[model samples]
Target: MIAFASFAQPPQDAIFPRHHPDVVDDMDVDLGEDDFERGYQRLTCPGEPITSSQAFMRGHGTYVDNEEVIASVAGTIERVNKLVTVRAVRSRYNPEVGDLVVGRITEVQPRRWKVDANSRQDAVLMLSSVNLPGGVQRRKLESDELQMRTFFEDGDLLVAEVQAFFADGAMSLHTRSLRYGKLRNGQLVTVPPALIRRLKSHFISLPCGVDLILGLNGYIWVSKHMSQSQQEGDAFDGEAVYSNRNDEIDGATRIAISRVSNIIRVFGAHFIPLTDTLLLEAYEWAVEQEGDVRDLLQEDVGDALVATVTAHN
Candidate 1:
């Protein structure tokens, strides 16, 4: 029988520095021989003894047995001071507060929307937490509650921030900011959540006129770029926030969006943590090769692209 471990937040100074602001780049924590001597083993298997419980506290992917901390899963071992955990090589998305996520509305309730954010449970987006048509600070009237579906109905996609967590660990989401709202003029791509690193900003715009929303939950939004004025100016249409209609997209822009999306898939398939710089390079390489956008997925071509883009990294 295999045990699936629950998610735990890494310590402030842990190698998996998801919560740290200083480490902005995608990085691999290299544990050398000297580091292993200091109790930082690279991997562990089930039932393997890790350390004495008296000397270290057992964390996720570990259990206390016979006064010793034993691995409960096969994965890389992570240590933070006296705490030890094994991060599974492949697992469901582990969410944290303040994470930017792209999610789909699964169910519309009385005053909230249930969003499937690829977590253990669906997240909640309260009616009070979203911005109404008129303005950001407007109070939610009874009429607004009645018209909640108009703002966010089932099957709609949105980009939002993880505002807080409920008593039961369900995430509370909010779209109060102008940047967070219904997603349109794009396609969604699903990848391993581990491939998305916590960066300074999840929103990325490539030179090819495509915008990306790198959801920490592994849902990626590839869409046409909207200018700053069109997105946030005084003349921006407030009612369009919930409009399901997509604007007219030209052929060139559509191809660019598809190309960017395919490149992301290639990187994800290789288990590479994506970054803005790496994506831009990949795009340039693809265009220079003059291969059809669909050709990027060809095994030989994809391998070549990945090798070229990551050669210097």
Candidate 2:
């Protein structure tokens, strides 16, 4: 499992001189060894020299400069074999094949819907990619094309997988399975895409009667949990899968959803990588506080939550 640990900043006193009486004392301190030497590595600044051309091949976020590989973005240096790359601490999501993402429909074209997935270019959701409201294997006729908005219209949010890419590098998305469709009974939360670590399953159901969809593009969906029997009765029932309306939500479930959303917001503010374990721990801690869910957003409370959760991590 990937750890959602936060990197704490180094002490200011360690970086600057406190007593200036002795020049030898300052000179004797080895300033070259920083947090990078320790377990927590330092971030590489833009244009910082990373390695020699003969030693490592240039990768993403790096450029060749005078036979030396330099960082093109401020991020952490990642080395894979002889290739060196820099992963920006915060960047737009880069879609990979089979990556599950939640996106909002920006425009409805002739046979495709333009989606915003927090990338440089909008992703394309083709009409043929979705299962029509009649049956799983139903053919999409020209009449179906005229009523395409009935399935997904402008400003609708849906979860899908990266199917392919255009020549210009824009991603093409698909939603053919029951698991990939319109999102309802939920609220969306935005965070840094980097905070959401890759997991075996992005769909998470908490015991508190809330369900979570961790999108690779940092679009999180927190909603009421539904049982298999409630949702998986008949594949022929397209309304169950494609309906834009949300199921009836109770007061308890609503509170649980808000609580979980707030917990995610707190984690994002601390720049902590998000994982199932970390979210559960933070939720429990927040509940123990015996305060309103909104209280977690307070500066002092957020700090305490980060410190406690990171300590446990």
Top candidate by lDDT: 1
lDDT of 2 by residue, 1-313 (tens): 5865343444578778676665563212111223234545446878787777777789999999898888889888776667777888889898898998999999999988999999899999999999776455766789988988988889999999999999999999998876778888999999989988788999998888888999998999998998766655533586666677778999988988999999898888777888888888988998999899898887778888988998986
Q: Would you estimate the TM-scores of all the predictions?
A: 0.86, 0.86
Which 10-residue span in candidate 2 carries the lowest summed lDDT?
A: 26-35
Which residue pairs does candidate 2 place in steric collision? none
lDDT of each candidate versus the true structure: 0.86, 0.83
- The lDDT of model 2 is 0.83
Q: Model 1 TM-score?
A: 0.86
By TM-score, the best candidate is: 2
